[model samples]
Target chain A: MIGSRQHGGGVIAFTFIIALLLTVIPLPEGLRFLRPDWVGLVLIYWCMALPHRVGVASGWFMGLMVDLLTGTLLGQHALSLTVIAYITLKFHQRLRLVPVWQQSLTVLVLLVLHQLLALWISRIIGRPGVPWYFWMPSVLGMIIWPLVYVTLRGLRRGFRVS
Target chain B: MLVSLSVVLMVMDHRFKSLESVRNTLSLLVYPIQLIVEIPGTVTDWLDESLATRRKLQEEVDSLRTQQFMQQAQMQKFAALQAENIRLRELLDSSFEIGEKVLIAELMSVNLDPYKHQVVINKGELHNVYAGQPLVDADGVMGQIVHAGPYSSTAMLITDTSHAIPVQVNRNGLRTIALGSGTINRLELPYIPNSADIQPGDLLITSGLGGRFPQGYPVATVSAVQHDPGNAFASVVATPLAHLNRSREVLLIWPGHTTDINSVVSAPVEASAEKADTEAAPENGEAADNHSTAADTATATP
Candidate 1:
C-alpha cells in the first residue's frame, strides 16, 4: 500500500534539484514578485505530502546548506527552518484539507514568520537594518504557493490518491 | 542522521574550514547545471523583452543608445585621465596597477537565502581567484572572495555585515577601516574623531594597508558626514563606489605584493602618476626576484 501511494525518491530529489535551480536563477524586474522562495516552497510541499519521511530534521539539514551557500552565520537558517518544518507538520492534515487559495495564504504567513525570525536572529548577532528586498521572497513565496501545491498534488493524485 | 549531518556541515563551515574544499568541488560540478538552469529563465526573459511594442522598443533602444554614448564619452575622459596618470606615475617612478590583465568573471549563482548577502562567481583557483582576492567593477571595489573553489567561489560583498576594507582619503591619504552595515549601497567608516579632516565629498580609495586590496582603486565616497557631539566618534556615512548589484561583470585584482606596498608608495607616487602606473602588478609579482631593484627604484619605506 505504501508503495502504491509513495512518490519515488528520484522524483523528490529531482524536484529538490529544480528548487535549488529556481533559487539561484534571477527573476526579471517586472515578475520578481512571482519569484518564490524556491527552497522553502519545495520544503513546504514535501512536508505536507510526506511528513513521516521528512520533517523538521530534514528542513534543518537543507537549511544548513542554504546558510553555507549564502555565507550566513551557521545555525541561523537551521533554527528558522526547523521551526518552519515543525509548524507545517503540526497543521498539515488540516492544511491538506483546505482549499488551494487558503493553503497559499497559510504558507504565506509561515514564510513571513520564517523571514522575520531570520531577521531577528540577524539583529541579535549584530547585523542591523535590512533592505525591503529582503522580504520580497516571502510575498513571492505566497504567490507561488498555489502553483507548487497544485503541481505536487497533481503528481500525487495522478499516481496514488485515486 | 539529518541533525548530525547539519552539525557536521555547521562545524565544517565554521571551525575547520573543510567545507570550502568540498564547496569548490561541488561548485565546479554544478557549473554546467547552472548554465542549464539559467537557460529557461534567460529564454523567458528574452521572450518577454521581444514582446514589447514597436514604440516601447524604439524608446528602449534610444535610451540605451544614449546611455552607450554617455559611457563612450566617459571612456574618452578616462583615456585622457589615464594618460595623465601614466605620466604622473612615470614622474614618481611608481608602479602602474590597473585594468589590463585584470581577471574577468561572471556571476555563477547568487546565494538563495534572503538573510545573507553573497554571490558565487565563475572564477576560482584555476582562474587565480583566491580567498581574500579583491573583487571590483569598473567603478570601484565591491567585495572580496572569501571561499575559493576549483571553478567557482563565494564573494562577500562589502555590503555584507561581516566584510570590511581598509580605505584612505584621496585628498590627504588618511587611513581608516570601512565596515559594511549589512546593507547594499551603504558602508560605515566608524571610529574617526569628529575632528578628522574628512569632508562629505571626500573619496575613499584603497590604502593597501590591509595587504588585501590593491592600492588606488576607489572604494566609497563620503555621502554624509556628521560629527556628533553626542557621540565620541564622527558618524561618517559613505556609499560604495561600485554599482555591484547592477553589474554582472567584475574584475578580480590580485595585489602582487604580500607586504603592504603603500607602507612604500606613500612617497612621490602621490605627487605624480607616471611613477605609479608603470610599476603596478608585475613589480608586485616579480619584484620578489630582485628585491634591491624594487627598493631602489621605488622608495624603500625602510
Candidate 2:
C-alpha cells in the first residue's frame, strides 16, 4: 500500500500458491522422511519481503490452509505458524540486517520454534506423537533455508522483472 | 480483511458443513499446480526404474518366476480343493465368502508432521477412492482412508494412534484390538490377560470386529510378549505385517456391497441411507441386518 510496486501483494500471494503446490507434491517413501516444510519456507520469504502487511496473521491463514490441505486438526498449524510469524516480526529489523550465515542460523531457530510449538500442541491435544521424525521437517527446512533464501534473495535483489 | 476472510472460512469449515464444497472446489483449483510439482518426482522414478541394470532386472524376473512356479505348483491342487470346499459349503446352505475389491495406489508423500501417521496416495476420489477404504500391501492391512480428495487422497496408516483395527489370534481366533503407536510398522495390543493364549510369534489377522476391514487379512506378528507375574495384563508388542516402509504400491479397498457388521453399525441408518454417497461397499448378509442394528443404535446414542 505504500511506495511498493503495484503488483507486490499479488506476486506475494502467488508465491504462497506455489508453496502450497510444492507442499502436497508426493515424495518417494524414502525421501518422504526428508521432505521440507514448503509452506514455512515460502512464508518466511514473504514475511521478510513484506513484513508489515504479511506478518503473523498471514502465517496463521496459510497455516490453516496447511491443516485443511493435510487433513489435520484445523488451527493446529495455524497457531504455531502465527507464533512463528510474531517472533519473526518482533525481530524483523535485526533479521533483515544480519549476514547470510547469521540469518540461516536465525531461520534454524525459527523453524525449531515452529516445530516445537506444533509438537507441544499435538501432545496437549491427544494426537499421536512420533519420535524425531516429527521434527525432520525443521531439519530439512533449515537445510533448505540457505538455498531458498539465496535464490529468492537473489531474485529480489537482481531480478526486478516481477 | 484477508485475515477475517480466512478466519471466516476456517470457522465455516470447523463449525459447519457449509465450507466443504468450497474447500473441495479450492483444492481442485490447485490440481494443475499440484500436477506440475508432482511430475518431477514421477519422472525421476520412471527414470530410476528404466535405469536399473539388466542383471538386477533379470534377477528380479528370475525370483518372481521361481516364486510363481512354486505358487502354480500349489495352486493346481488348491483350485480343485477350493471347488470341493465351496461345493461342500453350498450343500450346508452357507454362502460363498465375499472378497475385497482392491485398487493399487502409490504412496505419494507422507505428512510433514512425524507425529501424525498419514500419507497421500496418487489415486483419489477420481479413482473411486473414498473414506473408510482399507489400505493394504502384499503383506497385510496397513490402514484406512479418512479423507478423500479429487486427484489425490490422504491415508491414515494403522501405526497412528488415531487408528484402530480389529484383529484376531490366527492360532485360536481370539478377537483383540490393534492400535497404532505412531511409529512406522508398530502397534500395541493392550489389555490382554497375562494368561491370554498368545505367543511371541503368533500371527494376528483382521477379526472383523469393527467391520471396517475384511476379516482374515494378516494384521501383524507378535514381536514381544511381556507376561509380568505381578501385572494381570500382558504387554504385547507387534510390528504390522504390511511393509509400511517397503511397499511402493498399496490396495485401497472400500466395502464393496459388504453386509459387514462394522459398516452397518458404525454408519447411522440416516447415514447408511446416504451410504450410496458414503463410499463403502456392502457385501454378505449384513446389509440386510443393517436395518435392525441402525434402528437400535439410533436409540442407543444420546
Candidate 3:
C-alpha cells in the first residue's frame, strides 16, 4: 500500500504533463477559440482529488508552464491558478460529497473566475479586449469537466492511489 | 503574495525588459514540449506535400518557370535603375541606399488569441534576429519582431492594434502614421488632416521616418478616404499588401548590413522600448519619439 502511494505522485505528474501537451496542439482557425482549458481542468481535478499532496504550489507551477508554452505574460496564468487551487483546497471535503453533475457546475463557475482573472491581467497590461468568442472555451471546459473527473477518478481507483 | 510577485514580474517584463533573457532560457527548456505538441500538424503538412500528384507538380513547375522568367526581366530593369539612382544620389551629395540583407524564416506556430496578431518563427537570436527588426513577405511589409528567443522568435503583425508604422504616399511623399486596427486587411491613418492629399488607390510605402523599417518598402494601399468637416482628422483606411494570414515564410531584414546604416544600432532599442512602454500603460512618448527622430536624421545624411 505504501509503494502504491509512492507511485501515485508519478501518475499525477504524468497526467499533468499530458494535459499541458493537449493545451498546445494546433487547432483549426475556425475553432481556435474553442480549444479546451486542459491544463486548468487537470490541475483543478488533482487539487480536488488529492488536496494534501497537490495544492497551490503545484497549480502555480503548471500555470507557469502554460504561460511559457503559449509565450504569454509570465505570471498571468500562475496567479489565477494559485488562487483557484487555494479555493478548491479549502472546500475539497465538501466538494467530494457532491454529485458529478453538480461538481461540473462548480467547475463551470471556477473556470469562469479563472478566465476573468486572466482577462483582467491582460487588460492591465494594455492588450486590447477580445470579442465574445474569448469566453467560449470556459463553456467547453464546463462540459468537459465530467469526463476529466471520471477519468482521473478511475485512474486513482485502479491504482489504489490513496 | 503570489499576486504581488506576478505584478512585479509583469512590470519588469513590460518596463525594463530585464526578464527577456530569463524568458529565452526558460523557452529553451520548454522547447521539447512545444516540439511534441507540433508533431501532428507537421506530420500532416509533410504528408500533404509528399502525396501531391505528378500532374499538380508539373503544373506548379510550369507556373514557377513563367514567374521566374518575368521576374528576371524585371530584375534587368531594376539593376539599371538602381545604378542610375546611385549616381544621381552621389551627384546630389546624398547618402546612397545600401542593399538590404535578409534571411528566410519559417512560421512555427501562432498565438491563438485573435486580438493579438502574433506568430512564432523558427529563427531567433541565434540567427542575429533582434526585437523590432522588420519582417516582410514577397508582396509587402508584414510586421516586426518583438521577441527573440534562443531558437525561435515572435513577430507582431502590422494588423495588431498596438502596432504603428510610418508611411508616405508613394506618389506625393505625404507622410503619415499607419496604425493597425486589429483587422487583418485594414489599417487606420489617424490624425490626417481633412485637406490631406490622400485618396483611394494611393500607394503607401514605408517612409523610413521612424528608423525601424527601411525606406520605401510597399506597405499598403489606400482603400477609403473620408473627409469630415466636423472632426479635426479625416477617416482614412488602407489594406495591407502582405499575405499576413497565409504566408509560410518571412524575410527578416538586417538593415544596413552593407553600408553604415545609422539607424541600425539605436532603432530597435527605441522601437522596442516604445512597445514595452505601451504595455506598462505608461504615456511617456517623448523620449522614444526623440530618439527615433534623431536616428532618422542620422540615416538620411549617410
C-alpha lDDT values of all predictions: 0.70, 0.68, 0.78
- lDDT by residue for model 2 (B83-193), tens: 665566555553333354567889764344445777777887789876667789999987887667787777788888767776778998766677788778689988578
* Model 2 regions lying over 4 Å from their true place: A1-4, A8-38, A86-91, A98-109, A128-148, B1-25, B29-34, B48-66, B76-96, B109-111, B258-302
User: Candidate 3: which stretches are off by over 4 Å?
Assistant: A1-6, A159-162, B259-302
What docking tier does model 2 reach? acceptable
Judge candidate 3 at residue B173 and give its lDDT: 77
Q: Residue A74 of model 1: what lDDT? A: 61
Arrange candidates by lDDT, descending. 3, 1, 2
User: B288 in model 3: Cα distance from truth in Å?
Assistant: 8.2
Model 2 iRMSD vs. native: 4.1
2 against 3, candidate with superior DockQ:
3
Question: Per-residue error at B181 for model 1, in Å?
Answer: 3.2
Top DockQ prediction, candidate number = 3
What is each model's TM-score for chain A?
Answer: 0.84, 0.87, 0.95
**TM-score computed on alpha carbons, candidate 3:** 0.88
